[model samples]
Target: MTVTVQPSPRPRAARSSGIGRLLIAVYAVLALGAAGRSAVQIIERFDTAPLAFTLSAIAALVYFVATVALIAPGKAWSRVAWAAIGFEAVGVLIVGALSVAMPQLFPEATVWSFFGMGYLFIPLVLPWLGLWWLATVRRSERVAAAAEAA
Candidate 1:
């Protein structure tokens, strides 16, 4: 006679829980809003504020990537989320500082201008929140994987 042991199943990542659902929803809305704003800015008067409009487009892309990454499964998506959220935070900080120091550089506003003042600073805050969520999810995954392996 022979006996075999099966490993325990892994626990779900934190990103798939209730708070994650809310984060996904917020990211989706931000993506949509930024896309629309950037599209209008680029199409209507690209020459007037090319840099700002370009930054807006970039911000929109970041938001979209972050939203998708948050909903996606696996460690790969977690990495993507980290990259996207990190870039967003850096971009917002740089743009916010530049816009203040050199107002002429931003004749118009990008999603990150004045730390997303137009959006009630959501753009500034979102990336930090996303990073926190990703870190939490990754930690939980590691613990779960170790538990399963044992």
Candidate 2:
């Protein structure tokens, strides 16, 4: 008699290809960076630019949520990713324009300032990629479901 061992399959969420892995890596890094920046700004010199610091904190929260949502499995998590990424895109555009058009209003740069120039515009482009990724995942999921049904 011989004993054979079978390896457990990867989780559905973790089964994503390289694109998914890359997205997770980028989002996680951005989340950590934004969180640290906001914490220091709010703690040491928030009084100097309360609005800017507050916006940084908000950006951090958005990034954090997006990161988790992208990694989680299920329809609910996908919706969360959509909402967070959509909000990020809108926030970056609005804040970027405001920062450029009325510099005095900011007094200090937030994460979305100058269209995320401080982060090399990754913040500007990331949401678009995230949205695309979510759509791709959803499409694939639908295809899988249809195949299973058939």
Candidate 3:
């Protein structure tokens, strides 16, 4: 019997594109802004609002991690993105409420204070968008894989 030859599979496409690229860009910008703001706040006026300044630093770290995670490919990076985005959402909510309910606690606003009012509420809204994007990407990938199998 003649041997049947099989063609090699093509390389998988990159996951980060379109809205994914937009998300990464936003995260990168936010990361830079937060990091710079936190650095100045911590160095110059930490004593004025320790809680707020510390929160700013934390927000910066989260943003930085999220930006990197969103850009990187692999399930591990996706998990990191999930964790960072979720934590950012919670931080925004808690800090926003605290800043409003007890203004005394925050002599100065953190990046997340006022639900990220300073950043046009992007902090408040971005996480949900990111989560949705992640879910959509996962679903689409699954559908594609199923279709390929069939």
Question: Which numbered prediction scores highest in TM-score against the true structure?
Answer: 1
lDDT of 2 by residue, 1-150 (tens): 998986543223331355877988888898899999999999999899998989999999999898888878777888888999999999999999999999998999999999999999999999999888888777777776666566
lDDT of 1 by residue, 1-150 (tens): 898887657765767586788889988999999999999989999999999999999999999999999888877888888999999999999999999999999999899999999999998898898888888887887888888767
> What is candidate 3's CA lDDT for residue 108?
88
What TM-score would each prediction reach against the true structure? 0.91, 0.88, 0.88
- Model 3 Cα shift for residue 10 (angstroms): 11
The per-model lDDT (C-alpha) reads 0.90, 0.86, 0.87
Query: If the candidates were sorted by their lDDT against the true structure, best first, what order would they fall in?
Result: 1, 3, 2
lDDT of 1 at 23: 86
Greater-TM-score candidate between 1 and 3: 1
Model 1: CA > 4 A from native: 1-10
TM-score of 1: 0.91
